[model samples]
Target: MSDGPRLPGVEREADEDRIVCHVDADCFYASCERLREPELREEPLVVGMGYEEGETIGAVATASYEAREFGVESAQAISTALERLPRRAAFEDGTLDDPDLEREDTGYYRPVDMDYYESVAADVREILHDCAGVVREVSIDEAYLDVTERTAWEVADGFARHIRDRIRREVGVTVSVGVAPTMSAAKIASDFDKPDGLTVVEPGNVREFLAPLEVDLLHGVGPVTARELREMGLETAGDVAAADPEPLVERFGERGRELYDRARGEDDRRIEPKGDPKSFSRESAFAEPVEEPDPKYDLIETLADAVADRARREGALYRTIGVKAVTPPYDVNTRERSLPGPIDDRDLVDRIARDLFAEFEREPVRKLGVRVANLEFATADQTSLAGWESAVESDPEPDSESEPETGSERESGAEPGLESDPDPDPDSEPDPASGDRLVGQTSLADFS
Candidate 1:
């Protein structure tokens, strides 16, 4: 007889399939300002630290959507921002030469305040922790949650909305949430309809949803990578997904493989808490040292299966598979092999474990242990400059009035916040208005 199907809980879902939630606080720094100064709500507000009440010497830390409408943007020099969105104070105090500048034409400006922002972020973090079992806290303004165990595909939209609403009600800050089967898609989905938006990308529709997105929209595709992709005739994610991988690998190395996988919405990385154990193992003490290889091999298979199962249950991907042998007279020996990347293949685990144990197959064995190490857990972060909550007073809803932007419709889709790779020159500040996707810029939290 052959085994066909197993019952629920008998076999865990595939490692690639998961319900990942990406929560990103919209215009986080600017939103924190409105939380305390309610008067700033509905007004074009710019919070640029070091730019004093009447000075224009500092960089624009963040600009509200209202300010953005007037050509104001994050990282723009305050002097330039002032030229576009003249200060409301200047209009009120009649300091401008042109009396045509009405109060409505000007915007309020405030210095960046970090202490207050962090307290607000703390409240928001509390609610995210409660919604999912596994959360990777990426930064002060964004995080990734593995909600596979907490929810099903049928009602994932409601689950995501619930999170958005809870944060709005409790913390007084609006957040955009994206739900998808993979982390990369979830991150992109979260940004799909920003500013208190909620979008869910079902497993079946992941490919279709990602197909229309620009390569720049994909996570970790910085300006440099994007330029390279475009040069290779891969403008959108669909193009990259359909293109041959050999050239990509030749160009970007391992990252090329990663980029191709993400474009196809195939991220296998699981959301796991930081500081998790590096390895897991299963071992059994032999009643007596047996000289037979048949008995020793059987025990090795059992131990390998057990160790692999434990890692899977814990949502871990191990790159190294190892085995231990305790021979007669308690002499211990060990062997292991490391792979290029993390994986959750049980058969590979067994095969590798068995191969490693072959050296001791002929010797008498007292104890055998199977081990897996070099665990990889999902860790990820987000975009800033999204406006604060759209509807803070009443129940917030997705931006139903506005249509979500298709991949082609989005202008840049470059990540607005930190960069994926650390800057080689930490002290080298980026150009204030460089249009490229930048990293290591000053953040409100950094001020704190």
Candidate 2:
């Protein structure tokens, strides 16, 4: 790594030669089933919820390759999958309707064995961690590995095969591995050939490799977006890449530009692990920009209550309460107050949010939001105001007919940093200290 002088607020450049590897297990749940019951291998197996040897009531979780031949798919209704492929157990004992049903046409049905599958996934996860310097597990069965530090492009395919072989040999399950210079391309490459497949897209060949795929094949492009893209005459990745970007942007905002970029092999994202959320917030847009105080404050109070409830449910204590008010012409103005210490006080969250947003209550606001930040999560055993970290809110339940708090309940003296909070301006400085820890605060009100 170069010892370059790093400045605050400057974006870091993406490494062009970085190798990203996407590993996805082949029919993970069914594969796990086959691990214990070796007889289920290459057999038509269906793993789902509310499904037993004789009963069928819930949804399908996963269908093996053999089962999928008869139109079985994930998230499909259990009854629907059963209609296409009746349960083999019922057919064998002369129970299923229509006695002429062949044994080959029928399939095995198993309920979701999450605990066993998780154990199998843990073994696979260990192998992935050992193979790469950085791993981003997208789900239980698939992950992205940053192998740039581990292997070179010249032998990338062989390195990918080694990872695949390790999982299959050690864990008794097959995995498809895709290696590429970019994350988007790597993701597409992984699904190129399913069921124990491996594909590698070198540095310059990412675009060509992605060209022939359909629009929905790209990550984040779902059924609705793909249909819209099709209406715009962009049926394939190449179509989107070659079309005018102006129309695309008008249709889908920033995501349209992202689709165009990914179609052209222009993703700069690096592999990073998912982490705990920094803050929790909830917001709502008004039917029209309301200049009235009552409607605006009502929304703010509602949002504050919701945000606080979320924090309490998640076992988090917050030290900051904030409000967002979007004024006319799409300008987002925000204000927040930091407390002396973290507290799971719902009333306090509402109090501070309304106090901070008092200036914008009468202003023409198009949207309103409430947020709580500077969080400290507690364990399951610890939950209280003073000592325990895991305290659920102990507030009295409000009657359905009770009117909302309109700043009349607050006592004279206010919490420190809550009163006389400065608005964001060119000359003003943000409040950097809340309690023992540094608070990165932002207030957008008035210095005038």
Q: Candidate 1 at 170: error in angstroms?
A: 1.0
Runs of candidate 2 exceeding 4 Å displacement: 1-16, 52-57, 275-448
Clashing pairs in 1: 27-386, 419-439
Q: In order, what lDDT does every prediction score?
A: 0.68, 0.69
Top TM-score hit: 1
Candidate 1, residues 167-269: lDDT per residue as tens digits? 8875667889999988888988998998889999998888899888988878778677888899999999999999999999999888889889889888877
Candidate 1, which segments miss by more than 4 Å at Cα? 1-16, 53-56, 276-429, 432-448
Please, what is the TM-score per model?
0.61, 0.59
